[model samples]
Target: MISIRRFPIRIALCFLVSFPLWGCASIAQWAAPEKKATTSAPVEFVNAEQEFWTHFHAGHYDRIPQLLETYKRLYVLHPDHPVIAARIGFLHVWHLSERMRMGEPKASVIDDATLCRKFFGEASQLDPKDPRFKGFYAACIMAEADIHQREADTRKGYYLMKDAISDWPEFNLFTGGYVMSQLPWEGSLFDEALEWQWKTLDLCAQTKVDRKQPEYPAYATQDFSGAKRACGNSAIAPHNFEGFFLNMGDMLVKKGEVPVAKKIYSFARLSPSYQQWPYRNMLEDRIRKAEENLPYFRIQKREEISSKNPHLMFHSEAACMACHRTND
Candidate 1:
């Protein structure tokens, strides 16, 4: 809920919402249902190459080592294949993200981000014309911002993320991610964050995806996995980013804008994509917490009652009942 009550501190112009987590949705639609993945490929090469995705999505990283080798061999064999190059790059970032998820030390996270940046750099080079590759490359670089890089370099990466947004405004992942990065540096990004989040909601609301072009050689028909199926059929359903709402609510809460935070949390809880996130189940609880936290609830005491040796208590009737919907 956008509010009319303005604050002396940063409000519309400057707001940064921080809830840390790895970006999860595919560059395009992520789910592939028609092709059920098996541990063993009936065809050795196809099975070997796509085996990674099963383990990847199924949360089985132990198999990732073998999958990495298989992708390496495939990339070498097919040097011109953009998907192979991109997958290799994607894996490097994924490996680093998973490490961070496990509470890996900051030093280790920084080290992995270093490798991840290099991999995405190679991916962008491998597919120089695709904005997707360039965007992913920039996103990977952003991981190291303020964590492993100097302030100037982090600022440079921030501008690069802005460039990525310019390159593809239709892509909400980069837009929302860029907004996240900007909130800390620029309070003006508050308006921009709202603008982008609303646009993202529209993008997520759309039923169709416009991948536009597909490379036949880019796909391994034998195994529907990785970058291919993630974007193959434009008909594949789009994923919602309830996380974007979560992030916005977090920003509002940090600013003590409970009204707006409540609205955002409410909207987020209603999203189908909310169910997919780890915090989805917790959203309503957060909303109630925000409701309870709003200012000027009833306070009652009889200690100073008309000098009658009773306690004194006062409650802001309007404020107390403002957030309460129950009859009681």
Candidate 2:
């Protein structure tokens, strides 16, 4: 038995050595000669399209001009691509509008606007019925008119915004509609401005209603209560409604409708949709101010009497508190 085990151990050692040698020979025979390492080529500018949004989100607006130029050059190489055309239009509009808002030099603003108009024009030419193309085109026109500050330009802007509203009623028209409504008033086109504002409010209401629907486009939806319905399926979306509600609250406050304005402001502050936005801070600030001033305004008559009778002593310290309860 000892001899048998010793013999098997010796055989196993021999087989392991032979197996490795055989395997190494086979591997050597199968192996090819190594070549020089090949370097990866740089990505084309068109492929860098997604990076543009990354930069934008990082607040690297200064890089946008060069990025846009690169994108433009790339698009020129692929002019027939519908997606390229749409991207060109969108980038042009967004960058130009943002630049204009930043109060860039008039010439630079104009050049950017011209580029936007051109791209949008091309996008529209590519697909006239594409809602995104039309909406973006109209937005570009309206934004350009706004930056130029031309009264006639504002009229054009208003019409363009109206077109967007008519064409894409499901989309949030907040910026375009707000600007259109305000511009006419600034330009002394009160009647037109009022009409625009009312129209905007109506659209806002409809958008809100649509947002509640389960089938709402994703892109058309904003953070307002109406978004879930408005954005049934799209990807482009709006900011929260805090800013819009604040604007409405301010308007109502100016109109001496404090209670209603307060209610709107309070809603804006409390709404989960708006809790993350900078405008939420603004809403909170406004709410505090309103709360502080509301008591005085509510007792305007008493304040007047107090001012007139400054020397008169009150019968009780709680006299003012009686009318100005914290509940109010």
Q: Report the number of the highest-lDDT candidate.
A: 2
lDDT of 2 at 212: 16
Q: How many residue pairs clash in each candidate?
A: 12, 18
Worst 10 residues of 1 by lDDT: 311-320
Residue 109, model 1, lDDT: 42
lDDT of 2 by residue, 1-328 (tens): 5597699898899999999999999899889553222123236743665676555444454676777777777666666545556666666555543432343223454566667766776666666666556666666666666556566865665676567667665442543443333232233443343334334445554533221121213323344444333322112222333444554444444334567666656644433444444335545665667645433322323224232221111111211121111211
Across 1-328, the per-residue lDDT of candidate 1 in tens digits comes to 4445656344534543221112233422455333221223234456754565555544454455677687778766665556666767766655554442343223454665665566666666655666666776666666666465466765665576567666655553433353353243235655565546445444444332212221122121223234322221121222223444545454555445677666766655443334454444445655766645332111112121122221101111111111111111
| Superposed Cα deviation of residue 113, candidate 2 (Å) | 2.0
TM-score of 1: 0.54
